[model samples]
Target: MKIIVTYDVKQILTEESRASYLDEWQKEHASLLRECDHLQFEMKRLQKKRPSDQKWIADQFDKEIRTRSERMSFLDFKMDQLDQLTLGAEIHDGEIQSIQEVQMGDEWHGREQKGKIVVKDGIVQSIVPDSKGKDIMI
Candidate 1:
Protein backbone atom coordinates (compact mmCIF):
# COMPACT_ATOMS: atom_id res chain seq x y z
CA MET A 1 0.00 0.00 0.00
CA LYS A 2 1.04 3.59 -0.55
CA ILE A 3 0.02 6.80 1.19
CA ILE A 4 0.56 10.44 0.55
CA VAL A 5 2.61 12.54 2.93
CA THR A 6 3.31 16.25 3.15
CA TYR A 7 6.74 17.76 3.69
CA ASP A 8 7.87 21.28 4.16
CA VAL A 9 10.06 22.95 1.56
CA LYS A 10 12.71 25.33 2.87
CA GLN A 11 14.74 27.72 0.82
CA ILE A 12 18.24 28.94 1.60
CA LEU A 13 18.04 32.59 0.71
CA THR A 14 20.73 33.99 -1.54
CA GLU A 15 21.33 37.24 -3.34
CA GLU A 16 19.76 35.80 -6.47
CA SER A 17 16.56 34.73 -4.73
CA ARG A 18 16.29 38.04 -2.91
CA ALA A 19 16.59 40.00 -6.11
CA SER A 20 14.07 37.74 -7.82
CA TYR A 21 11.57 38.23 -5.03
CA LEU A 22 11.99 41.99 -4.99
CA ASP A 23 11.55 42.18 -8.71
CA GLU A 24 8.40 40.10 -8.64
CA TRP A 25 6.89 42.19 -5.86
CA GLN A 26 7.72 45.40 -7.63
CA LYS A 27 5.90 44.23 -10.73
CA GLU A 28 2.87 43.24 -8.67
CA HIS A 29 2.85 46.61 -6.92
CA ALA A 30 2.98 48.46 -10.19
CA SER A 31 0.14 46.40 -11.62
CA LEU A 32 -1.98 47.01 -8.54
CA LEU A 33 -1.32 50.73 -8.66
CA ARG A 34 -2.40 50.82 -12.27
CA GLU A 35 -5.61 48.99 -11.43
CA CYS A 36 -6.39 51.45 -8.64
CA ASP A 37 -5.83 54.39 -10.96
CA HIS A 38 -8.13 52.94 -13.59
CA LEU A 39 -10.81 52.34 -11.02
CA GLN A 40 -10.55 55.93 -9.81
CA PHE A 41 -10.85 57.28 -13.34
CA GLU A 42 -13.92 55.16 -14.03
CA MET A 43 -15.51 56.17 -10.75
CA LYS A 44 -15.09 59.84 -11.55
CA ARG A 45 -16.51 59.45 -15.03
CA LEU A 46 -19.50 57.46 -13.77
CA GLN A 47 -20.33 59.86 -10.91
CA LYS A 48 -20.11 62.82 -13.24
CA LYS A 49 -22.64 61.27 -15.63
CA ARG A 50 -25.03 59.98 -12.92
CA PRO A 51 -25.07 62.51 -10.11
CA SER A 52 -27.92 60.74 -8.29
CA ASP A 53 -25.90 57.50 -8.05
CA GLN A 54 -22.70 59.26 -7.09
CA LYS A 55 -22.72 58.23 -3.43
CA TRP A 56 -23.35 54.54 -4.13
CA ILE A 57 -20.81 54.46 -6.91
CA ALA A 58 -18.26 56.20 -4.75
CA ASP A 59 -18.85 53.73 -1.92
CA GLN A 60 -18.26 50.74 -4.19
CA PHE A 61 -15.12 52.24 -5.66
CA ASP A 62 -13.86 53.22 -2.23
CA LYS A 63 -14.34 49.64 -1.02
CA GLU A 64 -12.30 48.26 -3.89
CA ILE A 65 -9.63 50.94 -3.49
CA ARG A 66 -9.40 50.27 0.22
CA THR A 67 -8.93 46.57 -0.40
CA ARG A 68 -6.14 47.23 -2.87
CA SER A 69 -4.52 49.74 -0.56
CA GLU A 70 -4.42 47.17 2.22
CA ARG A 71 -2.89 44.62 -0.12
CA MET A 72 -0.27 47.14 -1.24
CA SER A 73 0.62 47.79 2.38
CA PHE A 74 1.08 44.09 2.94
CA LEU A 75 3.20 43.81 -0.15
CA ASP A 76 5.37 46.64 1.10
CA PHE A 77 5.84 44.77 4.35
CA LYS A 78 6.74 41.60 2.46
CA MET A 79 9.27 43.48 0.35
CA ASP A 80 10.79 44.94 3.46
CA GLN A 81 10.93 41.54 5.07
CA LEU A 82 12.58 40.06 2.02
CA ASP A 83 15.17 42.82 1.99
CA GLN A 84 16.03 42.14 5.62
CA LEU A 85 16.61 38.43 5.11
CA THR A 86 20.29 37.52 5.29
CA LEU A 87 21.97 35.32 2.77
CA GLY A 88 22.09 31.61 3.70
CA ALA A 89 19.12 32.02 6.00
CA GLU A 90 16.50 29.29 5.72
CA ILE A 91 12.87 30.20 5.13
CA HIS A 92 9.81 28.11 4.63
CA ASP A 93 8.98 28.07 0.96
CA GLY A 94 5.91 25.85 1.13
CA GLU A 95 4.93 22.18 1.09
CA ILE A 96 5.01 19.27 -1.30
CA GLN A 97 3.31 15.89 -1.29
CA SER A 98 5.08 12.56 -1.47
CA ILE A 99 4.08 8.95 -1.71
CA GLN A 100 5.29 6.35 0.78
CA GLU A 101 4.83 2.61 0.80
CA VAL A 102 3.32 1.00 3.86
CA GLN A 103 2.59 -2.45 5.11
CA MET A 104 -0.73 -3.69 6.42
CA GLY A 105 0.40 -3.38 10.03
CA ASP A 106 2.54 -0.32 9.61
CA GLU A 107 1.72 2.65 11.75
CA TRP A 108 1.64 5.15 8.94
CA HIS A 109 0.77 8.25 10.90
CA GLY A 110 1.62 10.27 14.02
CA ARG A 111 5.39 10.17 13.66
CA GLU A 112 7.39 12.93 15.23
CA GLN A 113 10.07 13.44 12.64
CA LYS A 114 10.85 16.22 10.23
CA GLY A 115 9.90 15.68 6.61
CA LYS A 116 11.62 18.52 4.88
CA ILE A 117 13.27 19.46 1.63
CA VAL A 118 16.12 21.95 1.72
CA VAL A 119 16.86 23.83 -1.47
CA LYS A 120 19.48 26.37 -2.46
CA ASP A 121 19.84 28.24 -5.73
CA GLY A 122 16.93 26.32 -7.29
CA ILE A 123 18.51 22.93 -6.61
CA VAL A 124 17.52 20.33 -4.14
CA GLN A 125 20.13 20.31 -1.37
CA SER A 126 18.84 17.34 0.62
CA ILE A 127 15.85 15.27 1.57
CA VAL A 128 15.95 15.41 5.33
CA PRO A 129 15.74 12.16 7.30
CA ASP A 130 15.23 10.13 4.18
CA SER A 131 12.06 9.69 2.09
CA LYS A 132 10.48 7.49 4.74
CA GLY A 133 10.08 10.63 6.81
CA LYS A 134 12.62 10.16 9.63
CA ASP A 135 10.32 7.75 11.43
CA ILE A 136 11.42 5.10 13.84
CA MET A 137 9.76 1.94 15.04
CA ILE A 138 8.84 1.79 18.69
Candidate 2:
Protein backbone atom coordinates (compact mmCIF):
# COMPACT_ATOMS: atom_id res chain seq x y z
CA MET A 1 0.00 0.00 0.00
CA LYS A 2 1.16 3.54 -0.75
CA ILE A 3 0.30 6.44 1.50
CA ILE A 4 0.96 10.13 1.38
CA VAL A 5 1.08 12.50 4.34
CA THR A 6 0.65 16.24 4.30
CA TYR A 7 1.07 18.84 7.01
CA ASP A 8 -0.23 22.37 7.13
CA VAL A 9 2.45 25.02 7.20
CA LYS A 10 2.14 28.59 8.34
CA GLN A 11 4.07 31.10 6.30
CA ILE A 12 5.36 34.11 8.14
CA LEU A 13 7.13 37.06 6.58
CA THR A 14 9.89 38.80 8.37
CA GLU A 15 9.69 42.57 8.56
CA GLU A 16 12.67 42.91 6.22
CA SER A 17 11.18 40.64 3.59
CA ARG A 18 7.84 42.41 3.72
CA ALA A 19 9.44 45.80 3.43
CA SER A 20 11.63 44.71 0.53
CA TYR A 21 8.76 43.32 -1.49
CA LEU A 22 6.44 46.21 -0.71
CA ASP A 23 9.04 48.77 -1.65
CA GLU A 24 9.94 47.03 -4.89
CA TRP A 25 6.30 46.69 -5.88
CA GLN A 26 5.53 50.29 -5.04
CA LYS A 27 8.47 51.61 -7.03
CA GLU A 28 7.57 49.62 -10.14
CA HIS A 29 3.82 50.18 -9.92
CA ALA A 30 4.16 53.90 -9.33
CA SER A 31 6.40 54.36 -12.39
CA LEU A 32 3.99 52.51 -14.66
CA LEU A 33 0.96 54.30 -13.19
CA ARG A 34 2.61 57.65 -13.70
CA GLU A 35 3.38 56.85 -17.32
CA CYS A 36 -0.19 55.74 -17.94
CA ASP A 37 -1.55 58.91 -16.39
CA HIS A 38 0.81 61.03 -18.47
CA LEU A 39 -0.22 59.27 -21.66
CA GLN A 40 -3.91 59.83 -20.84
CA PHE A 41 -3.31 63.53 -20.20
CA GLU A 42 -1.39 63.90 -23.45
CA MET A 43 -4.19 62.19 -25.35
CA LYS A 44 -6.73 64.66 -23.97
CA ARG A 45 -4.49 67.62 -24.78
CA LEU A 46 -4.02 66.39 -28.34
CA GLN A 47 -7.78 65.92 -28.80
CA LYS A 48 -8.41 69.50 -27.73
CA LYS A 49 -5.98 70.78 -30.40
CA ARG A 50 -7.48 68.67 -33.18
CA PRO A 51 -9.92 71.31 -34.48
CA SER A 52 -7.32 74.08 -34.86
CA ASP A 53 -4.45 72.01 -36.30
CA GLN A 54 -3.53 71.21 -39.91
CA LYS A 55 -5.41 68.21 -41.26
CA TRP A 56 -2.36 65.97 -41.67
CA ILE A 57 -0.93 66.96 -38.26
CA ALA A 58 -4.29 66.45 -36.62
CA ASP A 59 -4.65 62.99 -38.10
CA GLN A 60 -1.19 61.98 -36.97
CA PHE A 61 -1.78 63.32 -33.49
CA ASP A 62 -5.09 61.50 -33.27
CA LYS A 63 -3.48 58.22 -34.28
CA GLU A 64 -0.69 58.65 -31.75
CA ILE A 65 -3.13 59.60 -29.00
CA ARG A 66 -5.26 56.54 -29.67
CA THR A 67 -2.20 54.32 -29.58
CA ARG A 68 -1.06 55.83 -26.30
CA SER A 69 -4.51 55.31 -24.79
CA GLU A 70 -4.47 51.64 -25.81
CA ARG A 71 -0.99 51.19 -24.29
CA MET A 72 -2.15 52.85 -21.08
CA SER A 73 -5.07 50.47 -20.82
CA PHE A 74 -2.74 47.52 -21.20
CA LEU A 75 -0.48 48.89 -18.48
CA ASP A 76 -3.48 49.26 -16.18
CA PHE A 77 -4.31 45.60 -16.66
CA LYS A 78 -0.72 44.62 -15.86
CA MET A 79 -0.79 46.75 -12.72
CA ASP A 80 -3.96 45.03 -11.58
CA GLN A 81 -2.27 41.65 -11.97
CA LEU A 82 0.69 42.88 -9.95
CA ASP A 83 -1.67 44.05 -7.21
CA GLN A 84 -3.20 40.58 -6.99
CA LEU A 85 0.22 38.94 -6.81
CA THR A 86 1.27 41.35 -4.09
CA LEU A 87 -1.82 40.52 -2.07
CA GLY A 88 -1.19 36.81 -2.46
CA ALA A 89 2.44 37.14 -1.41
CA GLU A 90 1.44 39.15 1.63
CA ILE A 91 -1.11 36.53 2.64
CA HIS A 92 1.50 33.83 2.31
CA ASP A 93 4.19 35.90 4.02
CA GLY A 94 6.32 35.40 0.88
CA GLU A 95 6.84 31.78 1.76
CA ILE A 96 6.24 29.38 -1.14
CA GLN A 97 5.66 26.15 0.71
CA SER A 98 4.21 23.81 -1.87
CA ILE A 99 6.61 21.11 -3.03
CA GLN A 100 5.12 20.80 -6.48
CA GLU A 101 7.44 21.92 -9.24
CA VAL A 102 6.03 24.19 -11.91
CA GLN A 103 7.42 25.41 -15.19
CA MET A 104 7.43 29.18 -15.44
CA GLY A 105 8.08 31.35 -18.48
CA ASP A 106 9.32 34.91 -18.40
CA GLU A 107 10.27 37.62 -20.86
CA TRP A 108 13.75 39.05 -20.58
CA HIS A 109 14.33 42.73 -21.09
CA GLY A 110 17.56 44.15 -22.53
CA ARG A 111 19.02 45.06 -19.17
CA GLU A 112 18.39 41.54 -17.89
CA GLN A 113 19.92 40.00 -20.99
CA LYS A 114 23.37 40.91 -19.73
CA GLY A 115 25.01 39.09 -16.85
CA LYS A 116 23.65 39.94 -13.42
CA ILE A 117 25.31 39.92 -10.05
CA VAL A 118 23.59 38.00 -7.27
CA VAL A 119 24.03 39.52 -3.88
CA LYS A 120 22.98 37.79 -0.69
CA ASP A 121 23.43 39.24 2.79
CA GLY A 122 25.11 42.26 1.16
CA ILE A 123 27.77 39.99 -0.32
CA VAL A 124 28.16 39.31 -4.00
CA GLN A 125 28.18 35.56 -4.42
CA SER A 126 28.44 35.17 -8.17
CA ILE A 127 27.66 36.65 -11.54
CA VAL A 128 25.25 34.61 -13.58
CA PRO A 129 23.66 34.93 -16.95
CA ASP A 130 20.48 36.86 -16.50
CA SER A 131 17.03 35.72 -17.57
CA LYS A 132 18.40 35.38 -21.11
CA GLY A 133 20.13 32.36 -22.57
CA LYS A 134 23.71 33.70 -22.33
CA ASP A 135 25.90 32.32 -19.56
CA ILE A 136 28.41 34.33 -17.56
CA MET A 137 30.73 33.07 -14.81
CA ILE A 138 31.94 35.14 -11.92
Candidate 3:
Protein backbone atom coordinates (compact mmCIF):
# COMPACT_ATOMS: atom_id res chain seq x y z
CA MET A 1 0.00 0.00 0.00
CA LYS A 2 1.26 3.44 -0.88
CA ILE A 3 1.35 5.67 2.15
CA ILE A 4 0.26 9.25 1.76
CA VAL A 5 2.35 11.68 3.77
CA THR A 6 0.34 14.73 4.62
CA TYR A 7 2.07 18.04 5.43
CA ASP A 8 0.16 21.27 5.70
CA VAL A 9 2.61 23.96 4.71
CA LYS A 10 -0.03 26.61 5.16
CA GLN A 11 -0.77 25.47 8.66
CA ILE A 12 2.93 25.50 9.49
CA LEU A 13 3.27 29.00 8.19
CA THR A 14 0.13 30.06 10.02
CA GLU A 15 1.53 28.55 13.19
CA GLU A 16 4.76 30.45 12.80
CA SER A 17 2.80 33.62 12.22
CA ARG A 18 1.23 33.32 15.66
CA ALA A 19 4.34 34.57 17.43
CA SER A 20 3.81 38.02 16.01
CA TYR A 21 0.08 37.81 16.47
CA LEU A 22 0.55 36.69 20.05
CA ASP A 23 2.88 39.57 20.81
CA GLU A 24 0.41 42.05 19.44
CA TRP A 25 -2.44 40.36 21.19
CA GLN A 26 -0.58 40.49 24.49
CA LYS A 27 0.10 44.20 24.14
CA GLU A 28 -3.53 44.89 23.28
CA HIS A 29 -4.79 42.71 26.06
CA ALA A 30 -2.60 44.51 28.58
CA SER A 31 -3.82 47.84 27.36
CA LEU A 32 -7.43 46.76 27.52
CA LEU A 33 -7.02 45.32 30.96
CA ARG A 34 -5.51 48.55 32.12
CA GLU A 35 -8.30 50.54 30.54
CA CYS A 36 -10.90 48.35 32.17
CA ASP A 37 -9.26 48.81 35.52
CA HIS A 38 -9.17 52.54 35.05
CA LEU A 39 -12.80 52.58 33.98
CA GLN A 40 -13.81 50.58 37.03
CA PHE A 41 -11.93 52.99 39.27
CA GLU A 42 -13.55 55.95 37.64
CA MET A 43 -16.95 54.36 37.92
CA LYS A 44 -16.41 53.81 41.61
CA ARG A 45 -15.33 57.39 42.07
CA LEU A 46 -18.36 58.62 40.15
CA GLN A 47 -20.65 56.46 42.24
CA LYS A 48 -19.45 58.24 45.33
CA LYS A 49 -20.26 61.66 43.84
CA ARG A 50 -23.68 63.34 44.00
CA PRO A 51 -25.95 61.74 41.38
CA SER A 52 -27.65 65.06 40.58
CA ASP A 53 -24.26 66.70 40.05
CA GLN A 54 -23.29 64.13 37.39
CA LYS A 55 -26.64 63.84 35.62
CA TRP A 56 -26.66 61.57 32.52
CA ILE A 57 -23.06 60.56 33.18
CA ALA A 58 -24.02 56.93 33.93
CA ASP A 59 -25.04 56.34 30.34
CA GLN A 60 -21.67 57.37 29.00
CA PHE A 61 -19.86 55.30 31.59
CA ASP A 62 -22.04 52.32 30.76
CA LYS A 63 -21.21 52.61 27.08
CA GLU A 64 -17.51 52.82 27.75
CA ILE A 65 -17.72 49.84 30.10
CA ARG A 66 -19.56 47.77 27.52
CA THR A 67 -17.09 48.62 24.81
CA ARG A 68 -14.20 47.63 27.04
CA SER A 69 -15.95 44.39 27.90
CA GLU A 70 -16.43 43.56 24.25
CA ARG A 71 -12.80 44.32 23.53
CA MET A 72 -11.71 42.04 26.34
CA SER A 73 -13.85 39.23 24.99
CA PHE A 74 -12.42 39.61 21.51
CA LEU A 75 -8.89 39.63 22.87
CA ASP A 76 -9.63 36.48 24.88
CA PHE A 77 -10.88 34.72 21.76
CA LYS A 78 -7.81 35.76 19.78
CA MET A 79 -5.52 34.50 22.52
CA ASP A 80 -7.29 31.15 22.54
CA GLN A 81 -6.88 30.79 18.79
CA LEU A 82 -3.22 31.72 19.04
CA ASP A 83 -2.67 29.14 21.77
CA GLN A 84 -4.24 26.41 19.65
CA LEU A 85 -2.15 27.32 16.64
CA THR A 86 1.03 27.30 18.70
CA LEU A 87 0.19 23.86 20.04
CA GLY A 88 -0.58 22.56 16.56
CA ALA A 89 2.73 23.91 15.29
CA GLU A 90 4.63 22.17 18.06
CA ILE A 91 2.89 18.86 17.32
CA HIS A 92 3.49 19.21 13.59
CA ASP A 93 7.16 20.06 14.13
CA GLY A 94 7.58 16.94 16.22
CA GLU A 95 5.91 14.86 13.54
CA ILE A 96 8.12 16.31 10.85
CA GLN A 97 11.19 15.46 12.92
CA SER A 98 9.96 11.94 13.47
CA ILE A 99 9.32 11.43 9.78
CA GLN A 100 12.77 12.71 8.92
CA GLU A 101 14.41 10.35 11.39
CA VAL A 102 12.43 7.39 10.12
CA GLN A 103 13.13 8.16 6.49
CA MET A 104 16.85 8.54 7.09
CA GLY A 105 17.29 4.78 6.57
CA ASP A 106 18.90 4.27 9.94
CA GLU A 107 19.79 0.81 11.23
CA TRP A 108 16.30 -0.05 12.38
CA HIS A 109 17.09 -3.69 12.83
CA GLY A 110 19.43 -3.16 15.78
CA ARG A 111 18.03 0.11 17.16
CA GLU A 112 14.32 -0.54 16.96
CA GLN A 113 12.86 -4.02 16.63
CA LYS A 114 9.84 -3.10 14.50
CA GLY A 115 7.44 -0.22 14.22
CA LYS A 116 4.60 0.96 12.04
CA ILE A 117 4.41 4.53 10.75
CA VAL A 118 1.29 6.58 10.41
CA VAL A 119 1.14 10.32 9.66
CA LYS A 120 -1.60 12.66 10.81
CA ASP A 121 -1.88 16.43 11.06
CA GLY A 122 1.48 16.73 9.33
CA ILE A 123 3.14 14.28 11.71
CA VAL A 124 3.65 10.62 12.39
CA GLN A 125 0.85 8.94 14.30
CA SER A 126 2.28 5.53 15.03
CA ILE A 127 4.50 2.72 13.79
CA VAL A 128 3.30 -0.87 13.92
CA PRO A 129 4.65 -4.21 12.75
CA ASP A 130 3.72 -5.61 9.35
CA SER A 131 3.10 -9.21 10.21
CA LYS A 132 1.42 -10.08 6.91
CA GLY A 133 4.33 -8.73 4.81
CA LYS A 134 2.49 -5.62 3.69
CA ASP A 135 4.23 -2.53 2.30
CA ILE A 136 5.58 -0.01 4.80
CA MET A 137 3.32 2.88 5.63
CA ILE A 138 4.76 6.37 5.68
Candidate 4:
Protein backbone atom coordinates (compact mmCIF):
# COMPACT_ATOMS: atom_id res chain seq x y z
CA MET A 1 0.00 0.00 0.00
CA LYS A 2 1.11 3.57 -0.73
CA ILE A 3 1.64 5.84 2.27
CA ILE A 4 0.73 9.49 2.48
CA VAL A 5 3.53 11.99 3.04
CA THR A 6 2.86 15.69 3.52
CA TYR A 7 5.28 18.58 3.46
CA ASP A 8 5.42 22.28 2.68
CA VAL A 9 7.77 22.64 -0.24
CA LYS A 10 7.68 26.40 0.12
CA GLN A 11 8.57 26.29 3.80
CA ILE A 12 11.44 24.01 3.01
CA LEU A 13 12.73 26.44 0.39
CA THR A 14 12.44 29.37 2.75
CA GLU A 15 14.38 27.50 5.43
CA GLU A 16 17.05 26.57 2.92
CA SER A 17 17.47 30.21 1.95
CA ARG A 18 17.63 31.27 5.59
CA ALA A 19 20.29 28.68 6.32
CA SER A 20 22.32 29.88 3.35
CA TYR A 21 22.11 33.48 4.52
CA LEU A 22 23.18 32.57 8.03
CA ASP A 23 26.09 30.59 6.66
CA GLU A 24 27.16 33.52 4.49
CA TRP A 25 26.98 35.93 7.40
CA GLN A 26 29.11 33.59 9.49
CA LYS A 27 31.73 33.40 6.77
CA GLU A 28 31.84 37.19 6.41
CA HIS A 29 32.41 37.57 10.14
CA ALA A 30 35.52 35.41 10.07
CA SER A 31 37.30 38.16 12.02
CA LEU A 32 35.63 36.76 15.11
CA LEU A 33 38.40 34.20 15.19
CA ARG A 34 41.10 36.85 15.19
CA GLU A 35 39.33 38.80 17.91
CA CYS A 36 39.02 35.67 20.05
CA ASP A 37 42.69 34.90 19.57
CA HIS A 38 43.67 38.44 20.53
CA LEU A 39 41.49 38.39 23.62
CA GLN A 40 42.97 35.06 24.73
CA PHE A 41 46.52 36.28 24.23
CA GLU A 42 45.85 39.47 26.18
CA MET A 43 44.26 37.51 29.00
CA LYS A 44 47.25 35.18 29.21
CA ARG A 45 49.68 38.10 29.19
CA LEU A 46 47.83 39.79 32.03
CA GLN A 47 47.60 36.55 34.00
CA LYS A 48 51.37 36.15 33.86
CA LYS A 49 51.81 39.65 35.27
CA ARG A 50 48.94 39.43 37.75
CA PRO A 51 51.02 40.74 40.62
CA SER A 52 51.48 44.06 38.84
CA ASP A 53 48.00 44.19 37.23
CA GLN A 54 45.35 46.60 38.49
CA LYS A 55 41.89 45.35 39.58
CA TRP A 56 40.16 47.28 36.76
CA ILE A 57 42.47 45.68 34.21
CA ALA A 58 41.41 42.15 35.20
CA ASP A 59 37.76 43.16 35.28
CA GLN A 60 37.92 44.60 31.78
CA PHE A 61 39.57 41.45 30.45
CA ASP A 62 36.87 39.29 32.00
CA LYS A 63 34.13 41.44 30.54
CA GLU A 64 35.60 41.37 27.06
CA ILE A 65 36.11 37.62 27.13
CA ARG A 66 32.58 36.96 28.33
CA THR A 67 31.03 39.17 25.67
CA ARG A 68 33.01 37.55 22.89
CA SER A 69 32.21 34.05 24.11
CA GLU A 70 28.49 34.82 24.38
CA ARG A 71 28.32 36.20 20.85
CA MET A 72 29.99 33.09 19.47
CA SER A 73 27.65 30.86 21.42
CA PHE A 74 24.56 32.71 20.22
CA LEU A 75 25.64 32.36 16.60
CA ASP A 76 26.20 28.65 17.07
CA PHE A 77 22.75 28.26 18.58
CA LYS A 78 21.10 30.02 15.66
CA MET A 79 22.91 27.84 13.17
CA ASP A 80 21.80 24.71 14.96
CA GLN A 81 18.20 25.91 15.05
CA LEU A 82 18.20 26.59 11.35
CA ASP A 83 19.72 23.19 10.67
CA GLN A 84 16.92 21.45 12.51
CA LEU A 85 14.23 23.41 10.73
CA THR A 86 15.63 22.67 7.29
CA LEU A 87 16.38 19.02 7.92
CA GLY A 88 13.51 17.91 5.66
CA ALA A 89 14.88 19.79 2.68
CA GLU A 90 18.27 18.18 3.25
CA ILE A 91 16.71 14.77 2.64
CA HIS A 92 15.19 15.33 -0.78
CA ASP A 93 14.03 18.21 -2.90
CA GLY A 94 10.88 18.83 -5.03
CA GLU A 95 7.98 17.12 -3.29
CA ILE A 96 6.64 13.75 -2.30
CA GLN A 97 3.79 13.80 -4.85
CA SER A 98 3.22 10.07 -4.70
CA ILE A 99 2.31 7.96 -1.69
CA GLN A 100 5.86 7.17 -0.72
CA GLU A 101 6.05 3.85 1.03
CA VAL A 102 8.87 3.14 3.43
CA GLN A 103 10.12 -0.24 4.58
CA MET A 104 11.75 -1.43 7.75
CA GLY A 105 15.39 -0.43 8.37
CA ASP A 106 14.91 2.45 5.94
CA GLU A 107 16.28 5.86 6.84
CA TRP A 108 14.31 9.09 6.64
CA HIS A 109 16.28 12.33 6.62
CA GLY A 110 19.23 10.24 7.80
CA ARG A 111 17.28 9.33 10.87
CA GLU A 112 17.79 6.11 12.88
CA GLN A 113 15.66 3.64 10.90
CA LYS A 114 12.57 2.42 9.05
CA GLY A 115 9.01 3.59 9.13
CA LYS A 116 6.11 4.77 7.00
CA ILE A 117 5.82 8.53 6.49
CA VAL A 118 2.44 10.00 7.32
CA VAL A 119 1.66 13.46 6.02
CA LYS A 120 -1.32 15.68 6.75
CA ASP A 121 -2.21 19.24 5.75
CA GLY A 122 0.91 19.43 3.62
CA ILE A 123 3.18 18.71 6.57
CA VAL A 124 4.78 15.67 8.09
CA GLN A 125 2.38 14.13 10.57
CA SER A 126 4.21 10.98 11.65
CA ILE A 127 6.46 8.15 10.60
CA VAL A 128 5.03 4.89 11.87
CA PRO A 129 6.64 1.52 11.47
CA ASP A 130 4.64 -1.39 10.11
CA SER A 131 5.53 -3.63 13.05
CA LYS A 132 6.54 -1.50 15.99
CA GLY A 133 4.59 1.59 15.02
CA LYS A 134 4.99 5.04 16.58
CA ASP A 135 3.33 8.20 15.33
CA ILE A 136 5.65 11.17 14.92
CA MET A 137 2.72 13.52 14.90
CA ILE A 138 3.75 17.14 14.50
Q: Estimated TM-score per prediction?
A: 0.81, 0.33, 0.45, 0.42
- Comparing 2 and 3 on TM-score, the stronger one: 3
Clash numbers, per candidate: 0, 0, 3, 1
lDDT of 4 by residue, 1-138 (tens): 355654322333355466564776587446666687898788778777885775667788778877877887777776676667644443332343335667776655523233455443247655454324456566
Candidate 4, RMSD to the unseen true structure = 12.2
Scored by TM-score, the top model is 1
Predictions in order: lDDT: 0.83, 0.47, 0.56, 0.58
Tens digit of per-residue lDDT, candidate 3, span 1-138: 223333322233244456656787789888988887888788768867856745466677778978988998998896786676534352222322123234454434523333234444445444444323343444
Please report how far candidate 4 places residue 56 from its true position, in Å.
Answer: 3.2
TM-score, candidate 1, is 0.81
TM match of model 4 to true structure: 0.42
- The model with the greater lDDT, 1 or 2, is 1
TM-score of 3: 0.45
Residue pairs in clash, model 2: none
Off by over 4 Å in 4: 1-16, 28-30, 46-51, 86-138
What's the distance in Å from true for residue 39, model 1?
Answer: 1.0
Tens digits of per-residue lDDT for model 1, 1-138: 776767788888999888877898899999889999999999999999999999999999999999998889998999999888889999898988888777788764553344888888888887764455553322
